[model samples]
Target: MKASVKKGLGTTIWLLSMIIILGGALAFALNPSPAKSIFGYRMYEVLSGSMTPALRTGELALVQITPPQDIAVGDIVTYAVSPDGTTVVTHRVVDKTTDSEGQTVFSTKGDAADTVDTNVPAAAVIGVVRGHIPIIGYIIGFVRANFIASLMLIIAAILVVLAVKNLSAGKKKKPANPS
Candidate 1:
C-alpha cells in the first residue's frame, strides 16, 4: 500500500477504536443499570474479586439474558438485588428451587466467599456469563468514578496519537522538483 493510503487506514482504525471506547464510557455513565443488554449480551464490570479465578476485578463480563429455568447450578449469573434493578450482583448458582409462591429462586454464592447468597429470585436474574474481557472493567470503573479526569485523559491521548500520526505522515511527504 502507498504511504498515504496506509497512513489513512491507520488513522481510520485509530479513530474507530476511540469512538468505540468513548461510546462505551458514555453509555456506562448515562445508564443506571450495571449491564444493559445491547445486541443480545450485556457488559458488566467486575467490582470485587468475589468470582476470582473465574472472574476478577478489572475484568469485563459479557452476559446473555437467559430464562431462569435454563440457568443450571454452577453457572455464573448477574442479578439485581435492588427494587429498581439498578444494583446488581454477579455470582455462581449453588442451588436452584421454587419459592413458596411457586416462583423460581436460586441460591448464589461468590466463588471466593465463605457463605452463600440466599434465595435470588429468577426475576432478578439479569443474565448468564457468556464471555469475559480482561482489564476493561478497571477502565470503565476509572472512567465512571472519575468522569472529568478520564475524559480529559482520553481526549489528550487521542490528540497525542493523532498529532504523532500527522507529524509522521508530514515527514514522509516530499516536495516536487521542477524539471
Candidate 2:
C-alpha cells in the first residue's frame, strides 16, 4: 500500500477512536437525569456562577462518581438540588457542615454568582469535578437536551472505521499475481 494511503487510514482511525471516547464521555457527563444515572451516567447542573471567569449559567458539569469523604472544602462538588429530588446541582466547596451524627455536609458556590448555596448533606453529593474544559460543558448539555441519538451515531462511526481499516490492512498484505 502507498505510504500516503497508510498514513491517511491511520490518522482516520486514530481520530475516530478519540472522538468516540471523548464525545461519549462529554455526553455522559453533562446529562445526569435520574434515568441516565441508573444507566451509569453521573451529571451535575450549574448554579451560582461562582466558578466563573470559569463555569457559567446553563453550563452543566460532569464528574466522576464518588463518595463525599473524597470532597475537600476547596474542591468542586456536584450534588442533589433537593433532598427529595434528583435534580443535580454543581458548585465549589467553600465551607463544611457536619451533623450531630458525625456526617459531614459541604457548602458550595459559583465564582460568578452572588451568594452561598444551601448546605449539602454528605449523602447528597454525587462526585467531585476533578477538572473542566470551559464552554465545552454547554455542548454536552446541548447533546443531552437533544437525546442519545447523536452519541450513538458517533459510536457507530468509530466502529465502522475501525472495521474498514482492518479489512484494508488485510488486503494490503497479499502478494502480487504469480502465474
Candidate 3:
C-alpha cells in the first residue's frame, strides 16, 4: 500500500478504537451503581448461574429501563433485592399480576431452580435484560480493580501505534538523487 494510504488507514483505526474504549470507560465511570443507568441502560455483572442457558455467570448483562407495566411473563428482569438498591438479582418473570394496591407485581424464578421466588413489587424492578456480552464482566472487573495499570496500558498502546506509524512512514521515503 502507498505510505499515505497506510497512514490514513492506521489513523482511522486508531481513532475508532480510542473512541470505543474511551466511550466505554466514560460510561462505566459515570454509573458507579449497578442500579443506576447510563443512556437508559444499566450494566450488571452476573454473579451466579441463576439465569443459565440464557445468561451465564461472568457475563455482562445489559438491562434497559422498562416500565413495570410493560414487563410481561417470560421476560428476564433485574430487580433490587435490597431496599437501598445496592443488591440486585436477575431472573425470569414467571408470573405477573396486579396487587391489591393496583400495582404490578412479578414472580420470578431461576431457570435452574425448581421453585419460584418471592413476588417482587414494581417499585423494586430495575429493568429488563436487553442483552449480554460473555466474559466481558471479568475484564471490566479487572480494569476497575487496577484502574491505574489499565490506564497506563492504554497510553502505552497509543504510543506504540504512533511509533510504528512514524517508522513505517520513514521507510517509505526515498533518498535524494546524486547531483
lDDT of 3 by residue, 1-179 (tens): 99789778978897788969886775674456755667999888888898888999889999999999889999999999987897899999999998899988999999988999999999999999999999988777777778888778877887897888788878778687899
Instruction: State every prediction's TM-score relative to the real structure.
Output: 0.82, 0.56, 0.79
Best by TM-score: 1
Whose lDDT is higher: candidate 1's or candidate 2's? 1
Per-residue lDDT tens digits of candidate 1, residues 1-179?
A: 89768878888997998889787768755576655667878888898999989999989999998998899999999999888877789999999999889999999999999999878999999989989999988887887788889778888988998998788778777677799
Candidate 2 lDDT over 1-179, as tens digits, reads: 99779877877878877988786676556544453652433555554456776566555566777777777888877777765556777778999878788989888887666889877888778777755555555665666676577578767977787789778976897898999
Clash pairs for candidate 2: 49-110, 49-112, 49-113, 50-110, 50-111, 50-112, 51-110, 51-111
lDDT against the true structure, each candidate: 0.87, 0.70, 0.87
RMSD of each: 4.0, 7.4, 4.5
* lDDT leaderboard ranking: 1, 3, 2
Query: How good is model 2 by TM-score?
Result: 0.56
Give the range where candidate 2 is weakest over 10 consecutive residues by summed lDDT: 32-41
